[model samples]
Target: METKIQTGPVSTKAQMQTVPKKKFKVKSLLGYAAFVGPALLFFLVIQILPFLMGLYYSFTSWNGVSSAVEWVGLENYLKIFTNDPAFFNSFIFTTKFMFAAVIISNVIGFAFALMLNAALKTKNVLRTVFFLPNVIGGLLLGFIWQFIFVKGFASLGNMTGLEFFKMPWLGDETTAFWGIVIVFAWQTSGYMMVIYIAALQGVDTSLLEAAKMDGASAWTLLTKIIVPLILPAFTICLFLTISMAFKIFDLNISLTGGGPFNSTQSVAINIYQEAFQNNRYGLGTAKSILFFVVVAIFTTVQVMMTKKREVEA
Candidate 1:
């Protein structure tokens, strides 16, 4: 007569709450610290400490020999802004070189990537050959190219009887500027090509085939489909080229030595001259700090603009 009912335990809101937060285990934290502590310590000591010292020195008037380092407030900065004509010229030359190098390198690199992306018998070999230049240090590459421009060009000119190579490459200002640009492009384009090639390989062949089947022209396909998909590569390549071109030093130094009346001088050369060459470390540090700011601004603007385009794409 009596009916027995069996029922499962009712789940409450408390039972459905999130799992308890992980406890702060000192052992786990110590393990993580053991893994990351060395790199962080080295970075702080090597990079951050020097940077802090440089910041302090920028406002001083230390000749780098005497123990006397007088704080000159903004005097160093003001002098740089007003009295440093050579530095200004160097800045101008560097800016011009940067624009030329960035544009030419990216264009050539992208073209090389496209060409290599095509199925070819010697693609791998060609890729290695193209990238070989980038493996060499800029200083060595500069010295090598310097010889080519000075001796090699003259010899070839004599053999071919061509007036083009006979002209002074590193002697004249305009030619010297273009000479550095040429070298920079030659050295840097291969690196960008590698990046672009990787990006191109990641592109979906199916989408490209479908677009082709829909009667899309090559140009349309490249601009509409390919470029949009691989925009991140463009962003990375542009940033690298811009920074490299801006901070150009060893190449300019070895190739031209900022010679023929400081015509080919770059900001790095200017800073170096002010510091070690001229024994004006404080002023040099000031110039360096300002140069860093300008570079940071330029690169930041470029990345922001390109990233915006990437989002739109």
Candidate 2:
């Protein structure tokens, strides 16, 4: 007891040695901040801030032109739910259009991809021709197609004496809906075709050759092998078309202008009319919020489903 006892357990030799800590590199941190800070700042200022503001505005009775913003709470949302048949109609039209456009566009794109995947000498030229429509601005494309549907088709109809081109492509409700779908598929398919072409090129040729050795038919090879391999491209093209079709504004506006008794009005057009034309900013924002939720759900479900397929494949 007289001998001095250690106050605590013996320390390890390594512990006795001073372990150097990582130096805080202000230079590295500054470098990271320098690169990412501007984009983060702009995103906050442009997108996030506007969205938060819109959320608050959706709860108020603020006519955009007026400085007097009355806080109306859920009145705008309640009006949309109880009194808005036009909004529902517009949503219905948009949903229908989305389905039709997605199907036709993907089909045509895949077909174009298959065509160009072959060793045709003119494939490169055709690819450019196909993708050119996608380069044309949507508003201009819509206008050009509008002229074709209204006038050029009529002239062709007269020349050919066929009822197909004679009917008012953008006049009647049924035709107007299909007219939009047609133009959308034509413009969009080319872009999707390029994606498919890229995906197709990446496919393993050995697998195809092996299938050929196994006496696999073209259809069988495509359905059983190639399609699964390229499912990601399908996912991408479908997502793009679905979003584009749902938010169709410039094209719908310039082409039909929601004509044929507003029968062809899309949800985007409805929201635009509510906000700008009707001067109901609060109600319009409410509709937009609702639209955002629905579209988000649909696209999320689609992506999840396709992702599962990719995993399985």
Candidate 3:
């Protein structure tokens, strides 16, 4: 029985390979720790701490600057739901803005993405031009639009005789609502477009080819095939639009400053006014918590509902 004795060279090579494998496992574990530890620590410090503090402060009657936090239980929350008319008004305005912004922004964004995705000579440059507005700070964008609505539009109206441009865009209730919508759409459409474009690009070419072979019209292809396939992107865009619209503050401040009568104030602006401006810290904290809950609930319900539709489609 010639037992083939493994050579020392072979044993040495095997040991060398094993040594690298062991080192790799240890190194990978260390790398994971290095990456995850800092992130977890930051989340604890920045996010968790503030969240806990906010929750604690919601039960207190302490003004934001006060050292004495007198716990008043559910009084703050009760006041908002029971005694607060302004809160309700802000809610109404926020809901309306959210509906309008989500519809217009997603529609325009999806439209632009569709057109740009269709090969055109100036598509890249066009995308850059369209997306440039989104990169500007919200406050700056709001101020620029303010000038356009206030000064530029007046000049244009004077020159071109367009009455609509001369209307009180930032001063009146109806016009202010639309003004916010217009600014929001302009600022956000590019972002939504980028998402839609990526989703559109990911769609299977073969599916489109089959649809074409079946003599599906362009409209039908878009309606039945393309739209259904990009439902995930729709979910994301809808979430972004809804959250951004509800929490709109910079544009509201810069453009209207809750103007003409707090008619254009979103929930965030209203909360700010209540807490800091009015010194109702407890009530404001309560409102903030409620706002968080409302957004979370609405977003969750919307995502689940749309995800179901996506599956059905």
Candidate 4:
């Protein structure tokens, strides 16, 4: 029998010919560009360009209307740090509000989630009712609550003879601070509740049942098991509440007008007033840049810390 030998070069050439290398398809590239180009262009034009301009303006002394924008390097920043007491006060108020709002909203939201997680007849309706406030715009919510605080509370106080309701909710500084806190918590808790509910639903039913079988009390299960498993939800809720509280403008403006001596003025309102009201565009831009840095630092730290906890859990 004659052995048929296959030549290596011939076999290699045949294999190479059988499998063709793919060329970069201009059609596919163009298709992708068509899909993504408009959004990218819009973002550059609307966000990135404006941010760059604002950064440049921060170093200049440009009152919004003036044709003369003199370079005043570091002067705006120096003024904010050294002389701007109102801006500092706003920062302090914003910090206080952030803590209060985050805690209260998360607590209430988590509680609502737990309650709704149980088999209930009215869960759907209750969820809708709770989330209704979130759908209302912040400005509208502020105005509505302003009326409620100014008029409705007084009416309820008269009918019920309750001193708590009768107090000037938006007139006094302390009350105004707490008043904003209440409205913030009320408006935000439902949204946080929705997030918590989604997280809660993702918890393994078997694990919960196993814990119950092991005689884990509700509080113990919550603290030891449920909370640990859903730490990501906490992180998200905290981030949202922190950002909202820090950037609180419309609510503060409409509700109290940062009144009772500017005690409730938020950093956002301060920036707006500096830029628009005072026409100190350079100073406002400087403050805004500082504000952005502070917010970035805070959210970054919070996310890092919470992410560490999440991993450990």
Candidate 5:
């Protein structure tokens, strides 16, 4: 009995160790929360909340001004599908614009990237010059180009006696479509050039030297060696240009005001008019949700395809 009474608190040390570990875990959690808490809260409040609200609003018949929100179920979506020619026209215009703008911008951008990637004295200056257009605000750029189309080009045409500059740049549907494409490509190409330049710099020079030693032609080197390695850049630039072209608003709005009739109206412009101008808030939200789905599908597919190419590369 006396020996039994001499038994120590056997689990005391183990309990002490566990206390510190629990404290450490709490501290680590606090650290994570300290770093990520504010940003998470801000994102939830700003982006996620609004999106959820829009999703709910899409099913309602609430005009922007009215306090009484009527739940109209799928009526807004039905109207968009059946009765909305303008919206469809806007979508068609946007799709066409996306193709043109993406192709032109990426081509011009890749060309600029190739040109500037080479060692030259004036390369830096030319880089700055090309990139300057991107620095200008879209609305401002649109206005400036609008003036050029109307006044500056007209003056130039008179001076040069060239019919090329004398054509209506933003009047007819075909010309207006091309006009937006030109402005978009000009504004976007420089940015793409910068991206491509960065990718080009990362390429292995030793491989390039070996390719040259193997008697590969310049075109062969570019097409085989250069392009494949920088496929990621193509993916990024194409994605950027596609999305930007699809959602073109400020430039088109300021440049042509969707004009000469709504021939050049973008999906964004149509959504804006439907929601705010026409006060069909529900219908507008529905259109936005639908457009969002379409865009998400496109961008997701593009990213997946590009990622597969990246893995293959």
Candidate 6:
């Protein structure tokens, strides 16, 4: 009885602790709302909404400005596969462009990265100069190259009497493709170089020293030590190059407008023509959706393959 009487008031400490927990949960919810709310809203409104709308319109016939949209089921897709020669041509063109751009860009970029990594004078300035083209807008760069290809280089050809520069870089199918590849490589290599430079810097100096102590040549150090260690960078660079090559649009447009005879047309340009020029919006949407799937699949496979190699390395 005496011990029971000692407990005069019940402890409310446990209840008080739980009150702060409720407040903390509310505070956490509010914080999340403050941080992520705006971004989520914008993403939904801009990207997700358009994507869903595109999907809907792909199954319908609308002239892009019409009040009425008629459902055509799978007609647009079927027509794209069976009847659209332009779509196939664009696909073939895009593949060719991708192959050339990826190879040249990566090769040149890796080479530059290696050179810059060496103890050389003016490496930083060289990096900045190489990266300047990447900072310039793609459309602007395209136009600049167009001028060089037509007006500037033509003038140089006249003065030097060089047959190579005399050929129509943007007019001929063979030369036009190479022109695109060359410009793209020039523009993007700097960015890739930065990545490779970082990777090269991360390499263990001790391992390099050990290789050198073992009398390994420069080529052997690059092949066995440098290359193997920087495999992750290779994976990233390849992924970026592949994606950029596949989705190229502004450069292709400004350089040739898929012309001379649509010989250099890319899938993006083809979609633009179908949607705007021909008023086949549904068909264009269908093609775009297919293009998106192809790119997604290709990028996914490439990343997986490259990542596996990185692990093996």
**Pairs that collide, model 1:** none
Q: Estimate each model's TM-score.
A: 0.91, 0.92, 0.89, 0.91, 0.94, 0.91
Q: What's the TM for model 1?
A: 0.91
> How does candidate 6 fare on TM-score?
0.91
Tell me the RMSD of model 3 versus the true structure: 4.7
* Model 4, position 282: C-alpha lDDT score: 98
For every candidate, C-alpha RMSD to the true structure in Å: 4.9, 3.0, 4.7, 3.6, 2.7, 2.9
Model 6 ranges off by over 4 Å: 1-22
TM-score of 2: 0.92
- Once fitted onto the true fold, the runs of candidate 4 whose alpha carbons sit more than 4 angstroms away are 1-32
lDDT of 1 by residue, 77-164 (tens): 9999899899999999999999999999999999999999999999999999999999999999999999999999999999999998
The candidate, 2 or 5, that scores higher on TM-score is: 5
Q: Using lDDT as the measure, which candidate wins?
A: 1
Show the colliding residue pairs in model 5.
none
Q: Report the lDDT tens digits of candidate 3 across residue range 7-58.
A: 9999999999999999999999999889998999999999999988998889
Q: Write the per-residue lDDT of candidate 5 for residues 1-313, one digit (tens) a residue.
A: 3555423565776788899999999999999899999999999999999999999999999888989999999999999999999999999999999988898899999999999999989999999999999999999999999999999989999999999899899898898889999999999999999999999999999999999999999999999999999999989988888788888999999999998799999999999999999998988999999999998888889989998998887
Name the lDDT value of residue 135 in candidate 1: 93
Q: What number of backbone clashes does candidate 1 have, counting pairs of residues 3 or more apart or in separate chains? A: 0
**lDDT of each structure?**
0.94, 0.93, 0.93, 0.93, 0.93, 0.92
Clash counts per candidate, in order, are 0, 0, 0, 0, 0, 0
177: Cα error in model 4, Å: 0.2
lDDT score, candidate 2: 0.93
Colliding pairs, model 4: none
Which 10 consecutive positions of candidate 1 have the poorest summed lDDT? 14-23
